[model samples]
Target: MSDASGERQSPAPFLRLVRGNPTPEEAAALVAVLTARARAVQAARDAEAAAPAPRSAWRAPSHPAGGHPPRGAGAWRRSFHPG
Candidate 1:
């Protein structure tokens, strides 16, 4: 693209090779490492999102909601009956 001159201009490179001039293999290696890191981070995020939430300590009953009736005759049978 060009300005009023209508001359073709080179597009700016998105990934600039800073500092040392790297060989093609080195650039490919850098890209591979970056991709792997990104994938690992995304996988961790997905696992966290899919994992079941832990029950709150306060919300759960510590022991069975009700215990045996005061140890009297036929109390065992009463235990089975709905509260």
Candidate 2:
């Protein structure tokens, strides 16, 4: 039980099952099952921080080669071909 930097601590599994001393109704049923497993891990971290937040359907055109279309060599000619 020496904790304040005195070392020798390790006992927590509910203090090693109350090292043969539990009576108060088995320590109030192990503190109501460790407080319902700490309220189910804080309600799963508040439903993962209220979820929803993931969107990106490709988008990055504000000029820099906007709607592309213009590169040398008759840009794939077609204005009445058949020569």
Candidate 1, position 12, lDDT? 90
lDDT by residue for model 2 over 1-83, one digit each (tens)? 88888989767675346367888898889889989999999999999999876544444454543345555678656333423
How big is the positional error of residue 76 in model 1, measured in Å on the Cα after superposition?
Answer: 20
What does candidate 1's lDDT look like per residue over 17-41, in tens digits? 7799899999999888888999999
Ten residues in a row with the worst lDDT in model 1?
62-71
* TM-score for each model: 0.56, 0.30
TM-score of 2: 0.30
Report the Cα lDDT for residue 67, model 2. Answer: 47
